[model samples]
Target: MLILFGWRTTIEQLRMLSLVCGHCHNQAAHHLFRRRTKPTIFFIPLFTISSRYGLQCTFCGVSYDISKADALQLGAHV
Candidate 1:
């Protein structure tokens, strides 16, 4: 899965780290090997003033600003 924020990518590269065998008697487990799937991407707009910026996740009620870099280290792409 790839997550893009502006020009920066959260998951730049992906590899199947590991695979586990499914239960032989489980019907749901049989479908686990299905190939095609689509990923859902969520985007939230942030307000920037001067060099300061504020961001909030719409999915979750998490509010943060650029000034709080020590706690939330947000990186900007040049």
Candidate 2:
């Protein structure tokens, strides 16, 4: 018998916030997402091994890796 195991990362959009893009210099909507990497057994997610976050621009479609504090600050609606 053979067993297949591996690691996989799942990305999910958690929220949307209005922010200005530095590269494009445009005030537009941005999306915040959560990345969870888990161990997979036979193509089934077993447990989360690591977690991360990111931000993506809605207009230019540029993505960025950001810290938790920065993500919260940028997520503020004003």
Best by TM-score: 2
**Candidate 2, run of 10 with poorest lDDT:** 69-78
TM-score of 2: 0.85
Q: What is the TM-score of each predicted model, taking all chains together?
A: 0.21, 0.85
1-55: candidate 1 lDDT, tens digit per residue: 8775532112111111121223222222111111122333355434332233333
Q: Which stretches of candidate 1 lie above 4 Å from their native place? A: 1-49, 68-72
lDDT of 2 by residue, 19-46 (tens): 8998798999988887889999899999
Q: How far is candidate 1 from the true structure (C-alpha RMSD, Å)?
A: 17.3
Error of 2 at 2 (Å): 0.5
In order, what is each prediction's RMSD in angstroms?
17.3, 3.2
lDDT of 1 at 15: 17
